[model samples]
Target chain A: MTAMTAPQTAPAPALIAAERVRKTFPLPQDHGGVFTVLDEVSCAVAPGEVVALLGRSGSGKSTLLRIMAGLIPASGGRVLSRGAPLRGPNPDVAMVFQSFALLPWLTVQDNVELGLKARAIPREERRKRALAAIDMVGLDGFESAYPKELSGGMQQRVGFARAFVVQPQVLMMDEPCSALDVLTAENLRGEISDLWQAGNFPAQSILLVTHNIEEAVLLADRVLVLGSNPGRIRGEVQIDLARPRDREQPRFKSLVAHIYTVMTHPEADMTRMLAEDNAEVERFRPLPHARAGGISGLLELVVEQGGTVDIPRLAQRLRLDVDDLLPILDAAVLLGFARVVEGHVSVSDDGRAFAEADILRSKELFRQQVLARAPLVAAIAETLRQKRDGTMRAGFFLDLLDEHYPPAEAERQFATAVDWGRYAELFEYEADQERLRLPEPEAVAP
Target chain B: MLLAALAIAAVLAAAGSGIGIGEVGHVALLGLATFARVVVLLAVSTLIWTPVGVAIGFNPRLARLAQPVALLLASFPANFLFPLAALLFIHAGISLNWGGILLMALGAQWYILFNTIAGAMSVPTDLRDMATSMRLRGWRLWRDLIIPGIFPSWVTGGITAAGGAWNASIVAEVVSWGGATLTATGLGAYIADATGRGDWPQIVLGVAMMSAYVVGLNRLVWRRLYRLAESRYRLS
Candidate 1:
């Protein structure tokens, strides 16, 4: 990618550097083995640069951001802050969160002044600095309001103020707008980009972790797509557009389209990716986490246009980024309903029929497809039917799934199975009791 | 079990073997002494536990070790501890006044410990990450993040510990160890003495006074603190 050859404009100082950062979560009963989350992930943010990590959910983008913030230690490799190896949380780095993470007990002024209070700043100076920071984040009048009393966007403004009050060199944001309404999110995004462009923002550089393709192109100078399953950088695209880039422009639309392709390119090589481990993994590995509603939603959309449509056009029509669209696509592919060929998604006959059918008939179709294709779901249903009690512990299936995939991913897939299986009326999972029971034989058609 | 005893005592009073209305003042004065003891015991236990409970709460390994030991101590029965306490303090002549408070505290402190542990463990990880990114560690971490986070739990612990201290004072006040006996002048001692001598009037009076004191304390004091914790310091 041209991102690798971006010229060194006066060799800007590196604010944050993540070199081969790897994180592994320990398994409960895997003895010495561990579940690798991020493997050999490397990136850096230089002065005047904004890099975005674009990927699907459960892709370790958030974990990578936390590593950059020095909030958590990597299992292997190192993170450097301001050109020095960082051992723990560094004062020069800060983060904004998806949840805002403001202290609900504290008022906005106190929340904004949190870092200053921790550093033992004198009371008078702390108040002045906190207010200035609050005003900078456009939260001037809401200083005395409690976090619970503020809107979601206002609360996040407090989050931004708290991070900026410390004047961090590298500011890391993990899905900062993911929790807000579109209008509020767009307003805040415009405000942030405006501040950064006018040289009014305090942070030297920002690393934004988001799954929105247009958001990545609009906000960052470089975009990196993190591939799931031991998240690694699969592709990088450099955005060369100028400030305040128009979305209606042909170039901006093309850049967004190009990223969609790069993110999905790995799916074609998925068999090769699995073959490196074992041939059985391609078929036996647990499915990606997706809901029946999401799968059906994608099915209905794809089948609407005579059961065939280009993906880029579908994405444009649906306004879904690759991250939001691909899970449903993967679910369809896993269920034998649709397949992606070249740049187009073509719905199978069954998918089209299911889309046209009413509720009961569609569920019947789903039940048939799931029973035929998903081994874990079929096994669960069979075990429940054979047992006199008509129930089995969820841990049994979780352990079975773990034999094929990493523990956490296996757990996610098992949860997805429970959702789809329940939707298809094949099995019912009681989360509180952790039991899976067979569906009622005399179940109503509805 | 104790509340049931008090209720049965209430029914007996309605059945005619009740405390005479004239001796209410004397029982009220005695009730004051027992109430004073409960306060002293609660204050001392809170002082010790607020630190230790909070420390154990923040550390998982320490919390695991603390759980079984604290449970054992809490359920050990304060009456059993008084014999050892009386023996230790009799020769030094400190067994009469402060011995009751010390014995009551040993039973009550665990309420504060376990509840505080639950609160500290639930202090959301995102908030902790905020602390780290803000470079707040060590003393700042404890004072700013952990302390305020545990306030609601502390209020809950304090209320339970206060009630448990009152229940404990009956056995803890007039403790007899081996061949020796120590007595403190409080409603707990008065009731124990009355029950021993079969004085129905004094027993009813004492039970009624204690019920009054506990109900009054719950409504006038602890309830307000509990509401404050729920409204202002609640994690949600």
Candidate 2:
């Protein structure tokens, strides 16, 4: 909140800005509702500043970026570019997509020339500018190569070259390095930092969406942290560090740690935050998209770190994006296996036992914890026990869940429940029949 | 009706009949005419259905309604229309040469429509967003993004449509209504005429010659285009 308000005092006009943006997508007809992806989120990117929108999977950061670029319209509020309302695609911006999005059939030269061609630049000038842009990205020798022929790293160079060729006022990138190998991603990140320091970057400002906390700390002058479950701005941080920032510096490490804290704050505490922000509290706890194995693996790592570990360091050590690690952490917390406090994760007593126990003992302990802590699994087991035949169709649960969740989310919740229940030996599922039933012995015993 | 005729012809072929090596030149000429007809029909189908299919596919709701309708139309036995088309041609005084092209197109055009729809749908959402952000519109958008995006599927549809058109020509090139029969100068007409006279050896020769043309055209042209699509235009 402080960072959001402080930026309003700046004298320079924002190159791209969003005013209380709200975006909703209609669910399938049978679901009978709309899913709110972003709610009353406001942020701005000023000239000569690199801003990073950071959040996990449900954060809607990418959706917000698209809305600002005017690729899609916000359901409510409006987007402003250069102090004017943007009606269609913003004319003063260029984008690099995470998927590289290069036309597979076009040569590298032609792909870089695509924006120029659209602007009706003459052929001779388009060719010259394209070559210069291609050369700037270190892709001079492969002008005739198709995107499919290039490696992922080289393909992204083309993505960069294409965007840079247009020389838009603001450049937007959606997880540009996410699709590359780790080494390639690192190399590209270093190059970007270098380019920013040299001050010859084609775009005056950059707005990138990323799930990497370290990436935000390294590349962005201002980092806006987004919260999930109807994503809104959770907090903002200003990096006052100088150029060619050192990752090993204590200040840099602390900023990374601070963002991890903001992101990993519990959802229960978020209820009060939601109240203050005047947004609806999420009544149903959506299951984190994590598997039992991943949850246990995360618990083992925590226990190995002497029952507690700093998350950013752990994430750095494991080479995981915040997107990959948060779900597993959420699952562990949901089952009472681990806890996160002030960016530090500590393995609970049960988590230690589960991590150290033999396979059979671990399964028994997992069953006990799931029945005691997981409401959806407990409800499923209780309903199966009450049924005379101990059998029910999965769609019955899906319909019940649809009252609270969209159809896709309802299906995912049912799937997670099935995985947890089956692992606990509380039920069995036949996918071909779409049926759920208690185990034969358990049904007969009751 | 055509199956019964072929079954009778099979029986006639079981009896002894002699064929001449000298017949090759004449059969080859007829094959060239039919080959030309298949190429021309395919080009026309490409021109018409590519745009229509792309339009349908780009709108997902529209595609859902259009796809099944297209499949249903393609499944209708095109030969069922021949007699009606023949009657219209006789009354209207139109040449069977041109009328035959329309009849063949009936069975073949749907292939391009459906394939183009699938291709348009498969163009990655990310690419579309990039295009929109870059402000690529109108002719620039089609030339740079949409056309290349759908090229591979278009080639695939074309191969199947050409195969269907060549098969349809056997019935399409010769149309009969009641006692009236119209014949066009192509390998399909030659085979139909040979079968009507129960000239078993000529029937076999004409069938072999048509098969040679279809297989050769696929090998020489369609296969090359398919390879180019696989190499250059395939989306990762």
Candidate 3:
């Protein structure tokens, strides 16, 4: 970043400027209506400077780059070059796509010469200029070769040559290295940095779009992070860390971590809120008709009534099948409506109020809990529902049970089952495993 | 065979001398001089046919007009025109030989002209665009860009024209009408006599000799020109 700062004093005027660009896409009525993909995003690139537009998928980084390059028209804002409104693709601005759209029929030299020839330079002069540009991209000896003869990286270099040969004032690269392998992308990035540092021949400024955070951190003097769900600029982070950045260094990691933390905090807070609300709802819900058979059922009943219930009292309320109701109470604690302290199960503060709530409120809270935990049970439920041969590994079945119930109860429920083979297809554990190997459910047959 | 070869060679030489004297000679001269005159006549005819071939190759409009016109001109019996041509030229105080030879060359020139136009029109579109973007326009464009651009077509047209010109010379050299006759000392007159007398061997010999010359010239010259164009100038 110190290396990047040296050129900041006399930063050139904005070569390409976009103001309040908004791109909205209409959705089918059935798909929740219209959505805005880019909302009033504005950014500028100074001449001879490199700026990275960093965003996750669907953040409109590529779209904004296209608009700036005049490849696409912005719906609501103006893109200006040197403070003059851009009408169409200007010769002073050249764009390289990630796909490296090179003309297959032309040799490298002729491809480079395309711009020169279009400008009507004399033949001898065009050849000389095209050769120099081709050499600059390090494709000197491959001048006579066609595009098919070059690798992905080499072809991209040719694309660079084609753009650079024209000596455009601004070069717009749309994820130029995204399609390449890691090492190739790194090499190309180094080459680009070197070129920008040298500042030869028209001295182009670059506006690049990428999803790679480290790439943005390493290359750009400033990285703009866009927020999702109708993509808009969330914040801009200035990386003052010196160039030739060490990715392993504490400073770099902390910066990345800081960005990540800021971006994810909203989602985290929402999850916590939903969990608390569900716990409240569960505590207030009225007990369903309970059969007087097991201590497990009595403990559930006591918890549903918004009362602090102990395992010993729960065991006395219902005739015991097991030595303790501790496992059942533990399972209830894990489900988040009750807390276990010493030997007693009690409603959590949120859960106690929820137990006395109106039915409608309880139902809404129940729905949220189910929806929140749906993904946890979805895989096992799908597997169980689709069972054909009636044999599933026990481990997978136990895992799903453990997610919904506490681990010890889940184990006990399996141990007391009437027909293990009937549900064997729902699990992943083998019958041969020592801890899980049980008498056939018929032998225990209770 | 020897007589037929010598006779055709002698007529070609005479045509060359006709072209050497001046502008009129180049366009209007007739009769024999030496063996080198055959080579000179061949060279001169090639020059006249070059642009005509190119125009026909590059310009569809010219080719459409020239194709049928050439066919009609080539097939028209020069003998049928002999009486009319003789009376008209004699009355106008013009030489019948020059008029007759000019008619023969015209029939031959069309083949070369049309073939050249076909070849030029067929040069690939990308190549045409490359030429255009290089700012090639007008006559220098025609010289450096268009002419070389259509060389292969020119060769095909040239070869076909050479055969047509040889055929045209037969009726051109031997003219007979109303008991007035004019003969050029060439293979065409010799073949005419042989045909009149039903001499099969002489007819066979004249055709064989012409075939040999066509084959030799194509292999030694036209083929080489085409190879250069295909390898160096071809866009693909």
Candidate 4:
């Protein structure tokens, strides 16, 4: 519904758009197939609005940003810049990288003038514009300083100056503040907000990719939440709040909470977004990056709170961001030990039992939960049981998982499965040998 | 001033030892020739390998294959080819002067390639992506991004290659194939010739002169460039 509402709300055509875009990278090994990063995902940034592409890691938000910038090509579909199919690098966009990707050898002024130099602007004019951009970012005296001499915040100011110097139609920033310290990040965020509010920002529109939900609410006119595992747009929320938004405002807090809920319910959102249901893929999605101990810790906390808690409030109480809390919540939900309805998380009866039980009883419950709900761990146990020696190389399972996940993600999933399996006593891992074996019958008991 | 003092001490010591002043002068002249040969060969090696290394380093696929091959080639003892090189010079009537430069390059060029490859590889993906998003291309990209990105690595390579060339000169300046020797008019040849005749004073003078040149070059040229690389060109 919000996706449909985008067209009616926008006053102008999109400055940049991805039309049914799909991108795939070659599998790292010789599997002879591709790994899909973005699959038929489409979003747009029109003039006069700051659009945030928000997602956790592996959601391909950055990849999508790169595609829209024409830094990399989409395997399928088109990236339209000013209503034309983009070719090579998009000439009308500039980017601020999370790394503050300034040339270390160049002075701040030279770094700011780089885009102008690339465009073949005359050197004197280039210097004047670069100096002005530098002044605008409050980096006037830093013009002669190299990036290494600057602090992270100062370096990012240089990054902003470089991007603004180009005066492109769309300014693309990839997690622009995520790499800074919390205090510095907040400071930069406020300054960026101030610049946007001042109404003299050089770019006509802004596109930001970030995993920080509060950041999206604070900065974006409309936030598009991206889903991972072959990234697709899961949901879109239009932030109707005016600029210079307050984080403590009821509307702002609610929007942040709503986006957190949408991000956590991957399968529910996917089914709603697509016409056909692909339950198998959703069921076998890679395990969340959470340990048994962490999941138990979260369950105990929820139980202490009377078994039901609003996710955002719980995150705030724990002083953890949604990104940190979501994975643990996802793991607990995946094991059928918890359920999330709306933005509130309620521990299931099994979760309460696991949280209160003694260590041995907890392991028994964990073993049952993992075997019944975790397909990868169950498959490993089953495969090891069928083997003559009751053992298999870890690579065999990794190779199997490579078809569904990227190599790094596959490796992570296998490691998580190993951790859970070992904790449940369903399987034993030989660290040095990289082999997995079923637990002996006696060891499996208790 | 320090180098000049060392050179004077060496010349006076050689002359006082009853090795004629003319002989010490000749040895000093030969040191200059060998130094010139090393400088020229290093320039040539850098010119050829910097671009090739940049090309290979920027492409991950090519770098994976070429890196090991360059290492393998660098490890192969260049002396094993000296006899063949000598025969070619003899047959083609090429002077040992030119042949010596080629022989030294054979041993020294790999340092540049290796360092350049590493430098190019170390150029951050973020910077390259930034350059791409800015639409920096061709010459501007090279000037702004690629060159400075790899400068520190290239300087490291240049330093190593120059050292390798100096060491290679002792063998490369004088080559022997099938009982015939081709000797270039350089300090390496002078040392070899002195050793053949049991002329210890001349040999000492030649070694001292060669050492003086290597130390002077390292201190004056390579050190400054290395400081520049560390101070300005380094990626944080």
Each model's TM-score, in the order given? Answer: 0.87, 0.89, 0.42, 0.90
* DockQ of predictions, in order shown: 0.65, 0.74, 0.03, 0.72
Q: Model 1 off-target regions past 4 Å?
A: A1-13, A29-33, A267-273, A276-284, A310-324, A341-344, A348-373, A382-395, A398-412, A422-446, B1-26, B59-69, B72-78, B91-93
- Pairs in steric clash, model 2: none
Better of 1 and 3 by TM-score: 1
True A-B contacts kept by model 3: 0.02
lDDT of each: 0.81, 0.85, 0.58, 0.87
Candidate 2 regions with alpha-carbon error over 4 angstroms: A1-10, A29-32, A267-284, A348-365, A382-415, A429-436, A440-446, B1-23
Number of the top candidate by lDDT? 4
TM-score of chain A of each: 0.85, 0.91, 0.59, 0.93
- Please state the error at residue A135 of candidate 2 in Å: 2.2
* CA-RMSD of model 3: 23.0
Worst 10 residues of 3 chain B by lDDT: B26-35
Model 4 Cα lDDT, one tens digit per residue, A1-446: 22223323255888998988999988766467788899898888899899999998888999999999998889999999888989988888999999999998789998899899888899899999999999998988888998888999999999999999999999999999988999999999999999999999999999999988988999999899888867988888889998789998999998887887778765654465365346556444679888889999999999999999999899889978766788899899989899987788999999999999999999999999998888778888889999999999999989878876777888999999999999999899998999999888887774
Better of 1 and 2 by TM-score: 2
Give the per-residue lDDT digits (tens) of candidate 2, residues B1-236: 44345434433443335444446567778888888888889889888888888889887778878888888888898889999999999999998888899998998888888899899999998999999988898888888888889998998898898888878888899999999999889988998888889986888877867666777677778889889888878887
lDDT (Cα, tens digit) per residue for candidate 1, span A87-117: 8786777789998988888899998898898
Top-scoring candidate (DockQ): 2
* True lDDT of residue B67, candidate 2: 81
Q: Which pairs of residues clash in candidate 1, taking residues 3 or more apart in a chain or in different chains?
A: none
